[model samples]
Target: MTDTIRQRAEAALAEVEQVSAVVLAEPTDANAIVPLKDADKPVGAEITKRMAEIDMSDTQSIVSFGSNAQAELQEISQSMLQGVRNKDVGPAGDSLRGIVSTIRGFSVSELDVRRKRSWWETLLGKAAPFAQFTARFETVQNQIDKITEDLLSHEHTLLKDIKSLDILYDKTLNFYDELALYIAAGEEKLSILDETDIPAAEAEVEKAPEGDQVMKAQELRDLRAARDDLERRVHDLKLTRQVTMQSLPSIRLVQENDKSLVTKINSTLVNTVPLWETQLAQAVTIQRSAEAASAVRDANDLTNELLTANAKNLRESNKVIREEMERGVFDIEAVKQANADLIGTIEESLAIADEGKARRAAAEEELKKMEAELRDTLAAAKSRRDGVGDNAGTAVPGA
Candidate 1:
């Protein structure tokens, strides 16, 4: 598909290169050559009447007498200039030049290549670069189509104007023919004045009476000045014809350009746009296939990793569960801690009992010592009192 467009594009460019130069047709109308168009029109009766009233004694009046022809020639020149202006191709040319490269850019953009996406993005679905490019490609395609439509419309206008330019080309040639007739007509008038009127007056001057001779000579001088002015007007009209000639080829060139633009625009619309769309579609299809394959491979790899991790976790969990199942209700470490705590309580109680017993034994021994001392003291006193009262006691016992 790309090759097809390339071939067509090369052909289109060749069409532009081979656009033949515009060959303008020369004037061939018998009426334009024989009977002058505007040149044959009679001058105002007012101007002709005023010419008689002007005194021959004034040289300025004589020289400026025949000026209607110059006025008409100037009018023709202005009309020709306006016609050229009306047929201008600048606007169309600028429109073509501005958008040609811009439209071409679309056909050769990054939309042609499908970018590779990273593996990690598979879960993010539609996050691939190719997916983004598909969206971008769609937007670009719409824009190109829009531009193509606009250019095709413009080419339609250009085609019509190219035909219109041909008509204008002919009209410009007609202006040239009209200007030629004017120059020729003015020269014919100048010829009669120079050959017939001036020679007759000069011969009459040699033979007329002295007073009438001076009057005839003044008339003769006025005739010669009028003739010279007419000739100058005719020369000026010839210059106007030159302007018409130059405008011919310029119009043809514009028409030629319009033709070339039409060809190129047609090629872009018919060939380039469709080819680009095909390529973009193909690129998107390829990328989608690649992404599907990558996503599947990526999903499989994830599944395997998850299974391996689950197996490792299952092994650890089973070992811990079996150890729990095989054990007694109380752990030995807790029992040992409780047993040590009980022994410390018992030993402390026994030490307290032993200390109390020792104190009681000491107390018993001290009590015995004290009691013996007291008894000894009392016996001694009693013995003394018995001896002293032995006599009195024997008497009291008798009483």
Candidate 2:
């Protein structure tokens, strides 16, 4: 039993020593690709099958995620506009009126509600508080609007990324399939060679014996080198697959955030509008009362002056709000550009992976053809030796 185990162990060791592991190097140049013709039949067929299935699923995922994100963005925009009309604007206008009334020494008759005041004039006057506060409100509202648009733009970008991810997933599947076939073929060929065949194989292993041992040694060395190259190529292919998988989720995260932000903007919009509307009404009433009282006191010029000043205030307020909206538009563009860059990067990576697969398939095919040629050459040599031996025996009969 001990001897049997020892013999088995030795046999295993011998087999291990004879079989070399090749480290295939990945192609350094950018043009590598997986050729359909070069891969092992079984491995190639299986890979093709798996890739097709994966692409179909990947396509569905991309479409679903993209559509959902776009829908949520539309909802977010509508929400942002919800309560924007009311909020604190009514109270804010009242606060302005109080300041204006105080500046006129608490006399509604003395204050002009319609004087045409320049921006500088208002800043220098007691109405500065009201103007400043209104300006600030416009700024805040503008910010909210801008951010909402940006989120939508990002949604579009995320959709594009989803498509890119799908493309990359397909390319990766192809590379993985090709690589699997290449390795399987190498291992399969090694498995097919019997122990008895080794001696005969070495005899025709494209090397010298006795006087040219160094040539034989060099041939073995070349085989080892080739094995190392194959290993490296396989490892790099695996790494590329992993990195692409990792980047896919980053896009998904950003998309989720976009959805959440849109929801918040919508809620804020719905609740804030009524407050502003109520305050605006109160401000209009107070302005009218002040105008009537001023006119009754024979302060028609004062009344006109106050009316003009109020008109100037309205114009300034509108300008500030418009500027804020414009800024939001710029933010949207920025988000769109960022999404484009990420998609481009994913496409570039997929292209590189494809090229590597092609190179590997080519090398695997060459190895198989070489092995077949070596087998044929050995068989011919053996046949020729047998024929010579038979002729020698016939000639020796005379001797």
Candidate 3:
């Protein structure tokens, strides 16, 4: 019976080792690319209205005029200064002087018409408005690019987190599977040791002859000692099983959280980033267009709106990523703790099993010794009784 218990215990331990090996062998890295979904195309109604309100006709007509006026003014001023330096009053000098006067008159006349608008209007809305629009547009574009980069970084981190959770999930499920099998095997062995074999042995010891009551009593004690040791082994196995069962919920909770995190990450990658990209492209187009003052104003407003919305989304997404990362760390630690506890329980169970085997061996050896002593005592008693009977018969009535 002790031998059977020892064998069963060893088998259970082997199962535990096998389960551990499987968990350790699982791959920890993720290899697949996360899929991205297409973003919705931006609406063009506001952009069309703003473009229509902007009258580029006047600006286009004056574009070449401004360039010609500035060029002629520079050339004439240089020529007039050079003539003064040479002190020339001949036909060549007079011709240069007349050309300078005519260019200056043209510039003054053009200035009178162009400068009729207020300085603020020229600076803010009329003079080279596209350049201002471009500057603002590029600024917001840069911001959009930065946000996109941050989102991608967060996406990568989330992927790693998902992989970690996947590994933990697999490991936990495998551990539970192995644990259940080990416990089942252990319970079966305990049943045989406690109910079937040990009881049968005790019954055999109880069937001894009346004259051998003392020997029978000693044998019964040995059987009881072995039975008690086996029961203790069973108790230890059950306790370990209970502890293992208690840890399952924590493991399962981590798995569920991991799934939730993956969904969030997918939403950002597939929908949010693409939508931002579309809006960014639309803003760039508006900034580059040669529209009227009203159109540029509308574009500015639209760009600011998009920038605000995108910034908010990016910030929110980053916050969620950080929170998920923190949770992932906690889940990993929890899994580690659970594994440690299970390993400790199995080790303790193994130790108890070993001790039970030793006790059973001692009981068997002690029982053998008592049986030998009982045989010797009975042999002596038989010899003494036979001698007394023979002597009584030989001496007859005289004795």
lDDT for each candidate structure: 0.62, 0.45, 0.47
Candidate 2 global TM-score: 0.32
Per-prediction TM-score: 0.50, 0.32, 0.29
Candidate 3: residue 20 Cα off by (Å): 27
Model with the higher TM-score, candidate 1 or 3: 1
Write model 1 residue lDDT over 162-266, tens digit each, in one string: 656666776667666656555555555556567887788899888889989988888778777767766676676667667767877887777777787777676
What is the Cα-based lDDT of residue 187 in candidate 2? 35
Clash number for each model: 0, 47, 1
Sort order, TM-score high to low? 1, 2, 3
lDDT tens string, model 3, 263-371? 4433443455456557556754654452455567778899999999999999999999998887754577789999999999999999999999999999999998996
Segments in model 2 whose C-alpha atoms lie over 4 Å from true places: 1-128, 131-155, 162-213, 239-255, 258-399
Clashing pairs in 3: 54-292
Model 3 TM-score, 2 decimals: 0.29
Task: Identify the runs in model 1 with alpha carbons over 4 angstroms from their true place.
Answer: 1-24, 27-128, 201-219, 300-399
- In TM-score terms, which candidate is top? 1
Cα lDDT over the full model 2 = 0.45
Candidate 3 lDDT (Cα, 0 to 1): 0.47
- For all predictions, the C-alpha RMSD in Å is 22.4, 53.2, 58.4
